[model samples]
Target: MKILVVDDDPNILELVSIQLNQAGYTVQKATNGFQAMELLEEELPDLAIVDVMMPGMDGYTLTRKIRAYADIPVLLLTAKGELEDKEKGFLAGSDDYVVKPFEPKELLYRINAILRRYDKAVDVFIQAGPLKINRQSYEVSVGKKVLLLPLKEFELLSVLASKVNTVFTRDMLIERIWGYDYEGDEQTLNVHIKRVRGKLENLTGEVTIATVRGVGYKLEVASI
Candidate 1:
């Protein structure tokens, strides 16, 4: 998952970025709200960590602006611990508020909590005919048989299964699975797709991954 951290203090930004990166999250840094806005224009992060106080366009304003454009969750990081400040943060569209001088572990806890809530709202079990995918568990099954997939293969399968019958361009899959900054070519994706196909073939013939010629690929389920 990716997280954008917006803070005027260079120290805080570095600290938070380090902590989040250590926790296996992709971290983006912005010195202030304007930078954060620019980054958002490029790509939306899974969540945003914004400081409540900044020079121009404080966290509250940034949060409101983010809410206007995207449903991305925001966690307000500030020194304000009073009830009113937290209320203001929520009013401004922050999903959670954390006072400064926080333990790294506590901050991570809050981040995970917000992400879990967001995932529950957006990610769920997907079913196509006899095939079933549990997003939370990273498990794929066909009827009574469960298939184990590698991380990349599972992610690739998840993306394809998420939208059954909808052709996903190779570029789209690369961006979604490998990330916008992926430096690899289509061959990498093709290899993973081949692996996913091999696994699925072992389970059931009802579900198939179809190549769309020069276009891309799609998950197709045969009518029983």
Candidate 2:
């Protein structure tokens, strides 16, 4: 997942960035709301962490602006712990709020909760012929046989199965699975695809991953 952290205090920003990065999320930092807006124009983050107090555009204004454009979740970070402050944060469009003296583990838990809620709001289960994929549980099964797959392999299969026969380019797969900041090359994606194909082969011709020469790959299901 990708997260954008906006704060005028460099120390807090760095601290949050480090913690999030260590937790396996792609983190982007902005010193203030203006910089956050600029970054938003370039790319939309999966979630945003905005401090309630800033120089030019305050966190509330920033949250409102963000809601106007995207449906991504926003988490407000500030020292205000009063009921009215939290109410205002929610009114301004924040999905969650955390006080400055908040525990790091609590902040992480809130982030995960927001993400889980969003994922559940959308359909988490995908079905393609005899193949079934459960995104929330990270489970893949063909008929009665449960397939064990590595994390990357499971994600790759999920993406392809989500859209049946729709061809997904290598770039699309990498961007969706590895994020925009993925440092790996096409060869890396190829390796994961190969591994997924190996596992799918155990399904006895029920599913197949078809490569489209110079294009990309698509999930093909044999007619029962």
Best by lDDT: 1
The segments of candidate 1 whose C-alpha lies over 4 angstroms from its true place after superposition are: 125-131, 134-224
Cα lDDT tens digits for candidate 1, 1-224: 67999999999999999988766568889998999999999998989999999998999999999999899999999898999999999999999988999998778777767765675578688888888888778789876788878888987887688667877677667766766567988999989989888888899988999999977899999986
Question: Ten consecutive residues with minimal summed lDDT in candidate 1?
Answer: 112-121
TM of each candidate vs. truth: 0.62, 0.62
lDDT of 2 by residue, 1-224 (tens): 58999999998998899888766568889998889989999999889999999989999999999888898999999898999999999999999999988877677777767865675566589898899988878888877888878888887888788667777667557766776566878999999998888888876578899998887899999986
Global lDDT of model 1:
0.85
Worst 10 residues of 2 by lDDT: 114-123
TM-score, prediction 2: 0.62
Q: TM-score of the candidate numbered 1?
A: 0.62
